[model samples]
Target: MGQALALREDFDGSDLRRLARGSRDADQTRRLLALAVIYAGGSRAEAARTGGVGRQIVRDWVMRFNAEGPEGLITRKAPGSPSKLNDVQRAALVQVVERGPNPKVDGVVRWRLLDLAAWVWDRFGISLSEATLSRELKALGFSKLSARPRHYAQDADAIDAFKKTSRPAWRMSARRSRPAPR
Candidate 1:
């Protein structure tokens, strides 16, 4: 094999062990301990055995440690898939949702997740599933809200009149059914 990579001059075996002791991340602690072994005059193969990784990974760790110190060993969250909608498209979607759907033009009074997904496909030519669109909408600070169903022909005035007339009858019946206090 070729010559082993040099560890950073600033840190020694004791410093690495101390850092490992203070580290909250388990992976970072393990990496630091393995590097500490190398710093204490252990071979790359021994360090790899200590880390439970191959010699190649131990070399990579050495490189990372040399470059960025202990912090480089901490694991980072992976960035998942890119958003299907850009800022302009997202803003337009927000505006469309806030403005509400038109029954005549959009053929729907209320917007469903599927309807919004279709609209996104039609307008931006990007296909998004309802669940994915819902997640996107949630990320954009939008929540699903649906109004309680009401009959189109229901009379508010008649309902109010009935409520006004029914209460006195209900109270009278209740009074008649209750026994007199001894």
Candidate 2:
């Protein structure tokens, strides 16, 4: 068997436990507690069990702790794929959205996500779903807004006058519906 791993002499079990308690991250707290157990002469396997991980994981943690201290115990984010649309394209898209669509050229008065997706496909050869296009537009600070539909010949003044004058004959109806007295 290999030689045992050594923890820093300055830190004891209590100090490790205190650090664990102070940590906001649960994983970091668990790793600190595991290291505390190891510092108290517990085996790597026991430390792994305490930390809820495999023995190899405990070994890795110990190495990180030795090299980088408590800061190294925290988890890091995984790098994902880059966005499909580049900065220049996104900026252009924003300007186009701000300008609105041309009814004569685009065939539609409003820019629907479906229309935008089709435009993107035609302009850049990028196939985009309506939902994806919507999400991208929202991320660029655009919100869904549609004008209320009304007939072209509708008069707002007439509608307001009708609302003011219209009243159901509730008093006559109530008198007619009264039961005959005994």
Candidate 3:
């Protein structure tokens, strides 16, 4: 048979249980609980089952707990790729969004993902896809909005008068040319 599973000599079953009970992190508490079971002379398989993980995982947890104490059992953040834009750049981008783009200079009447992507590339030298730019813009509190199309010479007064005088087609009374049969 392989070497029996065990915890560090310094930590006792009660100490492990107390740490497990006091821990706020669910994962950490689970690891501590498994360690407690192992320390109490329970089989490694039994401890793994109690911890709701595989036997190998419990073994790894025991090794970590023994080597680095309670902190080792806690979950760590997975390192992710750094953002393309820094805080200052993000803030500047937000400001640029808030101050509407100039139509004459930018050659665009309203903002679009393609236009924003081009602008970002030109200003910051960072090329981003339309979808990426869209997500970033959304994160900066900007949303996709398009203005309704209307003629520049349209008169509001005429529209109001038309609305006031017009009757809906559905509301028209049916008129019969022939008299009703007796």
lDDT: which candidate is best? 1
By lDDT, the better pick of 1 and 2 is 1
Q: Global lDDT of each model?
A: 0.92, 0.86, 0.83
Candidate 1 on 94-171: residue-level lDDT in tens? 999999999999999899998999899999999999989999999999888889989999999988877744344443
lDDT of 2 by residue, 1-182 (tens): 87766776777888989999999999999999999998888888889899999988888898888888888888868787566787787898898888989999988888888888888888888888888888788888999998787889999898987785657657555775889889
Among residues 3 or more apart in sequence or in different chains, the pairs in candidate 3 whose N, CA or C atoms overlap within 3 Å are none
Highest TM-score model number: 1
lDDT of 1 at 107: 96
Worst 10 residues of 2 by lDDT: 164-173
TM-score of each: 0.78, 0.68, 0.56
Estimate, for each residue in 115-173, the C-alpha lDDT of model 3 and write its tens digit.
Answer: 87788888899988888778777887778887798899999998887785656658545
Better of 2 and 3 by lDDT: 2
Give me the displacement of residue 64 in model 1, in angstroms. 2.7
Model 1 scores what on Cα lDDT?
0.92
RMSD of each: 6.5, 6.2, 8.3
Give per-residue lDDT, candidate 2, residue 35: 93
